[model samples]
Target: MDIKNVFQAKDVPEAINLLDQYGEAAKVIAGGTDIIIALRENHVKVSVLVDISSIKELKEIKTSDDWVEMGAAVTFTEVMDYFKGHKEYSGLIEAASLVGSPQIRNAATIGGNICNASPAADFVPPLLALDAVLTVEGKEGKREVRLEDFLLDKGRVDLNKGELLTTIKFIRLRKGQTVTFSKLGLRKALAISRLSTAVYLEIDDDEKCAEVRVASGSIGKHGLRERVAEESLKGKNLDKAAIDEASKVLSNEVEKRLAGRSSCEFKKDAVEGIFLKAVEKAMVHNGDGSYCAMGTQYYPRAAGKE
Candidate 1:
């Protein structure tokens, strides 16, 4: 790491000022899970590091009647703890809990996970499914951008030179609405996702799908909404046939998008199972306590990693 200066910011304003002063030469670091590796490998060139991990405002998790917001520095362990017993956030909990080993989860921040913009980022698919919004603050002002729009491409976001991603917000899951996530990895412990899917589902009084949003990871340049599959499920009963139809749509889209890649054949086939799992998990949350099959069973436990 060829870093010269490291600025420990106490708050958002201070962090922004540091970033404004250093511009492209400065990098905002919270967990250092990704950036540390990038800097060591010379993938990122920066002379100064602006640390925001200790900022109180960046570590807060706020909830309201209609929304849930989490600060940029909140770790995955923090996410698991705060939303542990809440069934509406089971998808988020599952994603956060499955990130790397426990030690890595303790240090990995949600903001870093999103900003790093890896195609296989676990939390991103779930956030995308929830239609989360990001708050970015800079010298100019604070502005909100939809999570999908904020992500420009792999390893890229809309954050400007002086801006920092402050918070991520999404509508609270109401009755009949839930989000679920599933991923295929080589092993259960410290396994990076080969493919993943997240489903946000709402079933109406008529037993029909009121709304459905599907997002996927590792099957594209970045986490992306499977809109065609979503369209297939909306307004239809979330029965075996509907889910199967949607899975087929998702698989076909994957095939088309990854036609020239060597992993295309495998991913196009593998995505069906992963998508099915995510949607089924979302549908099973019909007020039953059995919403999350894994219910707080964090991975990489004493039991062998499988």
Candidate 2:
């Protein structure tokens, strides 16, 4: 498990060249967050280490007409700094702020998070909820993959030999759109998650839900969207009864995948509580329930009040 070779690239072109030379025997290290973890566990063996942390092009944040494109090497700390004031990315900004600690956040990049492909990766649920896509470049050239398709299993992605994650793209949240992210890790600080959920919805003038996205992690080997629960909640009225029914759907979907886990019974109750709180918090601006005590006008799903 020794890292016998280490090569640092000054830019993306150099990085790509190094990867091309080493091919499958190579692995890119940006933040070194996941790579270090795997190396410590003796789970990953990369003969050629191409360090991409020095690459300038893969560390930018750009916004287009419909989306915000995040460079592969942009750290979680950088995301927090850049998106704190951005109107469209409140949910993502908050999620980034919650990753690891100050040191870990300073070193963990979004691409590394996605490419690491951990089922309980804290960032994946919110990104999937935003319907995010990925751009990957390899010797054959570049191609885009939907995040759902890119992550097929634990520690698995569609990235080919000599390929590098280039960017992540997602539409900017618009007016009337609200999103919530929740996670239950073993501890509050520096913990891997046990279960997590992301809820994003756009509400119409008639108080009905539109474009609802619900995804979860730690229920299986990969972070996946629950299509059954999402489809069931789409176009439904935003009311007490509908919210309760939607939570029921979510609980069952989670139950279907919770067998043999260390915390199925606890997850069964926590999942329902978390989803209901997410929906209720998202609807607070709609004038239905008491505001959460967090002193922020925004919905706080972890508080779990209706």
Top-lDDT structure, candidate number: 1
lDDT by residue (206-263, candidate 1, tens digit) is 5577888899999887899999999998898666777898899999999999999999
- Alpha-carbon local distance difference test for all models: 0.88, 0.78
Give the runs in model 2 whose Cα sits over 4 Å from its true position: 285-306
Tens digit of lDDT per residue, candidate 2, span 1-306? 678899988987788898999877888998998898798798887788999887888999998888889898999999888877654455577678778889999999999998999888878888898889999987778899989899978999998888899899888766667666777778888888777777788765444576788888777788888777788778877666776777888888777778777677788778888777655545553345422212122334422444
Candidate 2 TM-score to native: 0.90
- RMSD score of candidate 2 (Å): 4.6
Clash count (model 1, backbone only): 0
Question: Looking at candidate 1, what is the lDDT of residue 272?
Answer: 98
RMSD to the true structure for each prediction, in A, is: 6.6, 4.6
What's the CA error at residue 143 for candidate 2, in Å? 0.2
